[model samples]
Target: MTQGLAAAGCEVTLLLKAPVKTDRLVAPLTGVPGVTLRRPYEEELLPDLGPRGLTPDQAVGLITRLDTENRFDLVVVRGRRAAIAAAQAEALAGRLWTYLTDVPQNVAELTSAAVSELTDIAVASRFLLCQTEELRDFLESSVPAACGKSVLFPPVVVVPEGVAGSGTPHTPLKLVYTGKFAPRWNTLEMTELPAALAAQGVPAELHMIGDKIHRDSPDWAKRMAKALEDTPDLVWHGGQSRAEALRLSAQCDIGLSWRAPEMDASLELSTKVLELGALGLPVVLNRTPMHEELLGADYPLYAGEDIDSVADVLALAADPDVYRRAAERCAAASAKFTLDRAAERLRGYLDLAFPAAPAGTSPDRPLRVVVAGHDLKFFTRLADHLMSLPGLEVRLDEWEALRTHDQYRSKELAAWADVVICEWCGPNALFYAQHKRPGQRLLVRLHRFELYAEWPRKLDIDKVDAVICVSPYYADLTRERVGWPADKIVVLPNWVDDEQLDRPKLAGAEYTLGMIGIAPSRKRIDRGLDVLAALRRRDPRYTLVVKTKQPWDYWWIWNRPEEREYYERTYRRIQRSDLLADGVVFDPFGPDVATWLRRIGFVISTSDDESFHLAPAEGAASGGVPAVLAWPGADTIYSRRWVHEDTDAMADAIHRIVSEGRFDAARAAARAEITEHYALRRVCQLWTDLVVDGTAPERIQLDRFAAVGLG
Candidate 1:
């Protein structure tokens, strides 16, 4: 849990029984980032932090102070009175859980605390619920306060080495056991099975590798010695380190853990079963609902918890094919219990612990920010930036509702968030604007397409806190077209990450022209071809390159009746015109669009109207001199040199830049303009100030952003 959480951007602090002084012990953990290793109490204060060595008061006091100083989100503890201390530590921690072994005393102890406190509980298994009849009702009814808090939390294994098949033909079916040999485990019955198997002409060897029994079971040690002495084939290797034990187990065949059905400890999912299962060693254990859930009902090695049933496994292991199939099932079942995968399930177990921060609460907890929409291609950098902050948790669920418009699922997601920014002006914005839980701060960003869509006008503008626009042009257009409140709308220019886009252009790329989007008639594909024709007429080497999804693949355009004629004309022109047929190039849109954009000397934006014209901004960041056509709001966003009145003028400017050998200079100038106006950090800071600090967009002085200091 510590290793996985630390990797997932959580600041982890590991508390230990003793200070790790050895260099070899600490060296491996040195490079795990954002992890702090510390011991809360001195060794003298609590020698082993045991019930006898130190009082419960001392342990609780030390844990509570750690919670106070470090601000722990959850306090998870296991075994005896430590569970009691953890349940009481709920006062200081965000959430608390007592990981209990699935036994009668464990359930009773937690039930006593559940009535007094509100801590979550994670029991070992739901064994009683599935196997026992009357006890199932008693288990859930025992702790009324822990109705939804308790869960079956099984131990997860870290299967480092490859899992090997247990059965090897003519290898005496090397049976091994790694855990204790207690009477409750039916160790005497297990030990006698090897000799009985040898009498059946299926020779078997058993290796027992364990240190000691549980605290109260010292008598089982003497029983284990007598049983091993009686059996010639049973050998005791004593204790082995966990790593070496796992390695040694891989060499063995059938794993044995057949116990009586009445054994209380065996009722839960055993760690011993998992240990053998993870190593692909098929365990000969009793069949139960929990066992079936772990290894599936088809597991051939399951016995009736009897000595004769365990001896039956030797007959199967003697057969190469049947043993191989059973071994495969064990290996397959082990995959789900891996530490990393279990850590994800652990998140679900920990979810009920941390309650949702109430709306308008102080920054005492992480500000929950949820960015939800279909077209959130632009919000990734900002979302990532927010997550890296000290007191913020950002979740970007782009295209979450693409399969269905299920309102209930969307609301459940919205309840956890303090602020919800609907990226595109579509169904997500419409849904949140209508279903908003009153406390959530809703901000929806509208681009050009949504201005034409019906959902924008359908939005409940009253409930929306703000409408973010990539540029003032889009803000003005949406205000007039969609009739949204002018006061609520603000221009926060789309962020362009300059560092990732900038790259060296290919040799002889000074003559190549690039265009990003080529769909929707307003883009004027013919005009782009005309401009390219003029440039190509001057020099045949001048080619226009387009990188976007192929036109035929756009299902929405094909579905729209009005777009049919436009596409037909565009494709006909593209097929007939020599300049387009030969001089123009097209490639599918991919992750490396910046690399494709870098090969062009100039990027032309020929759209009739645009809110932000991200293609030209991205092209400028890619060190490509942008040749932007004059649109209604183009001049406000870009300089006059980039904006041209017509196709001929756009062609003339490109010609002038090439003729004067100013491609490098123009590229540098374009990059500098984008750097000054549309840098990622600079724009994200504007958004941070608006959503987090509640500073109005108009109040944000872009020139004085450096003075405000983003960090």
Candidate 2:
């Protein structure tokens, strides 16, 4: 990968954890053009962190020192510990591009610890390079933080030229295996292949390379040693260099990579198999999903765990026609991993990771902006983006509750700020407005819930410079309700982190309907139930998956008699209907909504009313089509096509989307819309203009098709 990046014109610095030996594989990369190798042990007099390897502290110190001196564009780490160390450094966390192969790669093996570990690194990284598509899919589905940031980056194969070969089948087919002889690798079991093939009336020679043996079991280790020494028609060459391995493999007709079932189910593709394929040799491997994707399901040489399956594949490989076809397929599959192709892929990924800034977009003088808020959930991502901007330094003054905060901290932050952004139009905004210093700018964002409270009425609008609203309708409403001037109101739509939300949907997601935040009785959980029943009546496969906290969990909402009664009635209706009862799944609320949305094909927003519903927009960002009911101002916020008149119409729209086999197309279009309008980049740019440039926020119109017929 280092060589490929260097070849792609990137100034690469390959940092080694320890000093390299003369015979090491990486020894050749030293002093290469466009590549500078750094051996930390040899360069710095560092204390020994632990036995035999670099510790996280050592890695952080080395990387920090190097970055200070050279100012690298990106820092790529290979393992979990290194990524964790880099993530700990606030200075370099945003620049990390992690390629972690050390974690559990398959869904079945993924544990909570692994997900937590991966999430920590993923939240801090600019990109993640996955070695296989299977691993990428697994990560995106299991780790919410890993969604949209991962890209496929399989092993690069540099095929040697002028290898000798013959199209005709040999009398005795030659089989070869190269790598460690571990129990799960089935290297010991592979020695029996020669005899198994001979018993099946197909003569074969088995060549085993590599000297690394895992003596996990004493008896098995002794048995393997005996097999290497005395097994007929089997030759053990121990271990050899890369060139020698290829030369030895090219001479053989077949490469043996079949392993035990545990290893067979791995999400990773064997590099040795691809190398052998690059040598123009057919490889006999397990029929894994990744292997099937590489060589196609019809590839002739797939083997199973048992010896009989091995013998059957070997017998088939003895035929010239079958051998020729397998060889051609292997060669074609391996072509994608060529060094030139890998270099091009690396360059393309770099372009995506760090897109060029627009011309003349120079940074302004440094600004210290303090984002003071009681509940900053909706604005946290915006704050993080602001911190990433070139000339801005942002800090958050988090409050204890909606109206409670540390007065000392809040006062200190307000006094020191060039601009103070009150996330919610509550006590934070009121306090900042009342305590504004001379030359200090104050901006307060008001959402739907804040308008109903007395805080906005009590807030002194004269002291505030601008009041931000999520929608134009809400902006006008806020101005009328709070008596703020039209010039003081700004309509900044809530942003969806499109990159974080967009991910590959799981199979059967097309039948799943999703609802987020069905609380307070006003969100209309009953209406969502009606839609689910309507859909299930047409097809029992349709199901509703609701992700939110139970209404009782919210004290204020549950305390209201109407809200409690509404939920009880809704539950009874669900329990009464057969189609609706078993078809609905209630998942507890959590932060991993990206992962949760993988199984959701449609986002249902059948609310009684909303100022600017964000769930459907989030769903659209995640490639799930939105089925929004025609609430007040719905057409202004969303395309008319997504806003249906009622639950029945919403159900019909969803059914039509599925029955016409246009679910993929519909979701693609929806995702494109979200990317164009509500994407984080566009909204971030608007916020940057408001905060840094002191540009007045405007009441912008959405739904470009509002004046036209339904689209």
Candidate 3:
């Protein structure tokens, strides 16, 4: 969508997560006309911030900053939380218009947050548009009322991500299934269909991508392997990279989408169905309401209750002419979901949401700002600061907690904002680019973690405007890694409130050492354990107290058995061992920083990398001595320059703090230093100068009230 908008002559800015790298998605967007992409949090760049998860406070603050940064014509979103974030950001910017993707039925009852965030809803089919009425009526009855317009249009189709047309036919029929292999997808169940086809002497093969089953499930891979064991021709290809998967699928003669009878499965239409059909492959799908609604009754090859029925359908599909006809129908159906058509619908919707600017008129209103991202602390502080600025009004926008409760639906609060701020890069960065408000500023803060992962590989960076980085180290790392222009990058370290640092130190606090936030990999808590072991060897009187909330394993998405086992074993050992003689303590729920400071003598940051060391800095403010190891990227322009690489230096620093009994004085001094540097008022002034004086002149704002009712 970002590329499509760029093609339509709109200036695009893309904000993405940390650790940005080269991939297929970035290739097209780079060098695309009128597009500027910025990823602020690439992991390789910033090593002070830990993990990618965001608190509600941080998300709101990020949106506020982005909204104040640049002007955008419209906001389009693909997911519910993203839409809501965009809407809230838009409301802050006082701009309106948002585009939503996905059919209503595809939204789970649990994920209605997307629908609620939209100023205007958009669907891929006229069929889906018709369903919007049912949604509207539900919204009016279920909630208080429904506002905004809902329109149906075609799905936005892109050139195949990995597959290209084979342009040649093979004798043996190849059947391909692409998409995440979750329980709802029932890919394992469909193994029977392929085995049955092979048994019946039909030249059929099943290829599956994205196996999501637990690796520990002994029967997981065994079930499929057993089904195809007898038939050497029946192949169960393991998960493949997106490009490899697409290339392999394009070589096939038939595409398949099989769903179990689960409620979520029955209602949602897989993107595979659309992509395969778009690629001119005949799709054989299970009979479900979603399929019927999407393909219509005339659509052929709906599998019945058993594998036998699917096998029979495969046999019939092997005929050349029958296959050809199906392929033609798929091609025709695909045209209805082209990116151009989706863009046109969005354009029309925007036309209705915001009327054209009057001839010879200039927009003089303060540019509205909105920000979105997962970091709550950074944003909360940032928002507080932005709100204090003279010519700007900043409102924090939070979507995670709301989305967790609301599902993916529409949001009523986002109709008023102007600009949006976000932690530019992550798994869901694309969601923001798709659902931007018309004529609003889109500012994105890039952190370090996104730079090294596959998540940013999928972002269309050309969609974002100015990107704010926490440090020069992060900025340099992002440019080198993602190849974004340096001019678009701005350095803005995360700020905090001084009042929040006023707690007193507790007696005997010298016995405790603290570490904050979660995510086992980034925090390198295991490494911290290693340090604890070393510390115990040096002094038996030392003890460790670690505070962290529930790990990601508690969430269904990361609930793999291996992950669960690792966390459990690690926790048990940490609880049972007496390496330091004084024993270890685990506080699943710790008091806020002020209270925690009273009990902690020193704070330890053993993180592998970070965008900003918020915990250590906060601990310093609370009077805990800061002991930070040199992060891997500390030598770069993006990391904090304070990191020391010498282990002896680090150990000595800890020893000095512990032996001197200077905890109270250190805490008081550290608090004073941080409070002055990161105070909310100081940061807000910087944001105001950047938003109003930096990018305000380039904005092209349309008069929403004047242009309403014109589409």
Candidate 4:
């Protein structure tokens, strides 16, 4: 990755984990134009740390100190420990881009601890770097935080010059294997391939390059040592330079890479295979999914686990026609992983990660704006973001109740402000619509609750410049209900502060489901319970956590006989069912929802209808996957992937997501979808354009709105 970035003309400083003596330097990066190797910490700093090198806290301190001095645009760290350390440390929050190379090889190897660690890194980093598409998929599936953030930054295969295969097997066909002799890699097993091929009436020799050997088992090591010394057709060349390795490998008829089943299941592609293919040598490897994608299923050299399978494949490769076809296929496949291609990919990722600032200039004086609302809970972040803008001066006109406000203060602020924005289309909106002056712009945001009320009909439509709805579904509904002009209404989604909400998930969060606000009977607490019952039937670990005020707390709802009956019946059902009795938990409502969401893995929305249910969206922004019932107009507000038709489908989706080990990927997709459509920054831009320039949101195109009856 460093080489590819350097090749793209970036001045990259490569930080060594432990201090290395400058006198003993490798020749590979000696002349790289834009690369520098820096050992910031001295040997004395980590004297007794052994081969493990720096601990997470030690790494954090070292990186923090170095970052302060260098002021780096991006800090690229590799491995789980380094990424977790960087993510948890406030000093390296926004700039850390982790290259995740040391994760589990497959879903079976993906443990709960690994998932939690990766999730922490995913939420904190700018983006997660993947070496292959398979690895990217695996990472994204295991860690929800990695869904939209994971990007491909594959290994750069530098092909040596003047090395090419003959496209025909030699008289005594030579087979070669490069890289370490590890137990799982099956390097020791290659010693038997030549003799096995000879039994099939095909003469062959096995050649091995690399000095490193992982002596994992004493018995295997002893057998490997004896084979290297006594095997007639085997030649072991201990650790040669790249140039020497390629030159020696070029002399061979085929490259050998078949490994043990466990190693074959890995999501990573072999760089050595690409290197051999760059020399125009066909590779004989295990028939894994990644290998099939790389060389194609018809590449002719794929082998299974048994020695006979490898031997059979080697004998088949001895045929000139088969050898030439395999060689061509491998060379074509390897072309995509060249150093230059890697450099181009790196440049593209960098361009997106650090885009050029958009051109703009501030106004002569800040525009005076007043936001009037009875409850600004939904609009506080939007108000705060607007105030931070360069050319905006904002103030709030707080009301005592929905229909009651200080008349004198409202008039004074209205007269003083250039623009007045009524957050809800209630009495405040009516006052602004009736009193709007010639030079003043009055905008009313109509939520679903206000649409049900008489506020829209009572408002002076002629004086109001524009009415904003949280979704196009609501916008169309409002237009029909109020009989407003085609162009009088616009659609802008409710905002979610992604930076504030995208926090690390707590351990065991994947099994904990959450539901927010079930005040009215229509919010569908029963449906949520049904879904929870279904999930708990499959896995007892599944539990539902409800965060809301009790039904009795709402006077209007509790006073109704139907509401009381519904609660009584729901309580009786929970008492009867084993799944519901122990699985349901209700916590008191509080303002600290962001903190509360850390323990929730999935957020359920089983409402019969909604304006733009902000709870699920907020949960998504907090890295929790939303399992929503397909309520009326739900598709417009959320992606169809998140909306299930019934409780059964919702339960099925939640179960499949967890059982298939794609909870992270599913949650990430939800989070990315919500953040992209309704982030605070994007909504603020729309508001600024409307408040300052009197421009309609581009999404509210005249033709599209007219087609959808929102014109």
Best by TM-score: 2
**Candidate 3 TM-score, C-alpha based:** 0.44
Q: TM-score of the candidate numbered 1?
A: 0.48
Give the TM-scores of the predictions, in the order they appear. 0.48, 0.84, 0.44, 0.63
- Give residue 308's error in model 4 in angstroms: 1.8
Query: After superposition on all CA atoms, how large is the RMSD of candidate 4?
Result: 10.1
Candidate that would win on lDDT: 2
lDDT per residue, candidate 3, 206-226, as tens digits? 766654454455766566456
Please provide, for model 1 over 574-642, each residue's C-alpha lDDT reduced to its tens digit, 9 standing for 90 to 100. Answer: 789876788888866655555576578888888877777888888889888878888888876777668
Candidate closer to the true structure by TM-score (higher is better), 3 or 4:
4
Query: Distance from true position, residue 101, model 4, in Å?
Result: 2.6
Query: Model 3 lDDT vs. the true structure?
Result: 0.56
Cα distance off (Å), candidate 4, residue 426: 8.7
**Stretches > 4 Å off in candidate 3:** 21-24, 43-49, 52-60, 82-147, 160-169, 211-244, 263-268, 360-711
- Cα deviation of 7, candidate 3, in Å: 3.0
